[model samples]
Target: MRRTFKWGFIGVMVLIVGLFLDYTLPQHDVVRITDTYNRVTPLGSLNRLFYASPDAGTKPGTAAPDIRFIAAVRPNGKVIVYRNEDTGWIWPPFFKFNSSNLQAEASAMKSTADAPRWVMVTNYGWRIPFLSTYPNAIGIRAVSGPDVKVFPWLNIFILVVLALIVVFFWRMWVRFRERTLDPLIAGGQERWDRTEARAENAAADVKSWWRRIIRRGR
Candidate 1:
């Protein structure tokens, strides 16, 4: 029984750990974005080129610098705007923007302190495409975060199972260690007391018989 209980506890712990990992791991979803640039170059060369050539002598009316922006979600629920320029793509964390800033923009947007869901983006300086799909986006991937609300039923189920397991083990431990010896000790003590009382009664009866016999002889 002890071995069985130990193994059961170990299995429960393993299951709990597995569930925790399942919620925390990152999942990637890829989509095609229209206003995004998807060019790949040698890793270190792009940074050098951007630093070397900083100035272009073109007028503002000619054309804006060709750059694209895309949204990306980190594994921990942080949203980042990736600015793809002529040099290379840069990741600028977007969660820094507050609700006040989002409300000022003329776009379909929902912003809160920690949660920002932008249906469309209006900033045009970066020339990024507005991916219309909410579930999926182009040049941007939405990843899963460790959100407890996502699986309420599973969470409740696990919690209830764990509580019941704890209660069961506690009862077993009590029965194994405490209840077993109490009954034996109590029974033995009662037997000893009864034997002592019988011996005293027998001694008193023998003394009475001796006195009666002596008195009759007299």
Candidate 2:
């Protein structure tokens, strides 16, 4: 009964630990829009600067035009203007743009019937910064240069948790084997019982033989 209870408790603990590992050890790109804006107007070839391939070329509301504009609408009402620099427009180097403004701008653009409709720009569903590199990086969290950091601490955390789980299970197995199974196997009660029985039989045979000899002599 004790063994069964201990094993059952161990199994439950293992399952709980496994669940925690599965839940806390994975990294996902959590896309959260901070603000919403009226429109997103790209600066310079901001489309070419930020997005590439399929996203490059057309500006919202203009077809076959030389330059295009891009923007993002955030959850809260705000706007991020991404003007096409090739259109001969020079934008200020510094601006106060947030996620909410970009979101609102995207919503407004989508509602209007422009040639190139404005839509939320996402890659694999995460809201990325405007530029792939820095200096001209437009998005809220985007750094100005190509030196954005990828967090390794998350990976390190997962490794530590996994190591702890392995150690815990290993310790449990060692305790069960040494404290329970080892003593039971080495105590030798069966061998001692057999030796005592053999000695008693031998003593009885010797006494019986002696009695027979005495009777014969008499």
Report the number of the highest-lDDT candidate.
2
Over the stretch 1-218, how does candidate 2's per-residue lDDT look in tens digits? 99999999999998997755543242322122222323233445543433221222334554332323344333333443342222112222123233344434434544322223223332211123544221121233332222334465765876788799889999999999899877776665666778788889999999999999999999
lDDT of 1 by residue, 1-218 (tens): 99999999999988987655343222233221222233232224323222111122323333333333354443355564543322112222121223222322312222333663423222212211242112111122222332312334644765689679989999998897678777788888899899998989999999999999999999
Task: Give candidate 2's error at residue 23 in angstroms.
Answer: 4.4
Model 1 clash pairs are 32-138, 33-138
Cand. 1 Cα-lDDT: 0.40
Cα RMSDs of all predictions?
A: 20.8, 19.7
Error of 1 at 52 (Å): 44
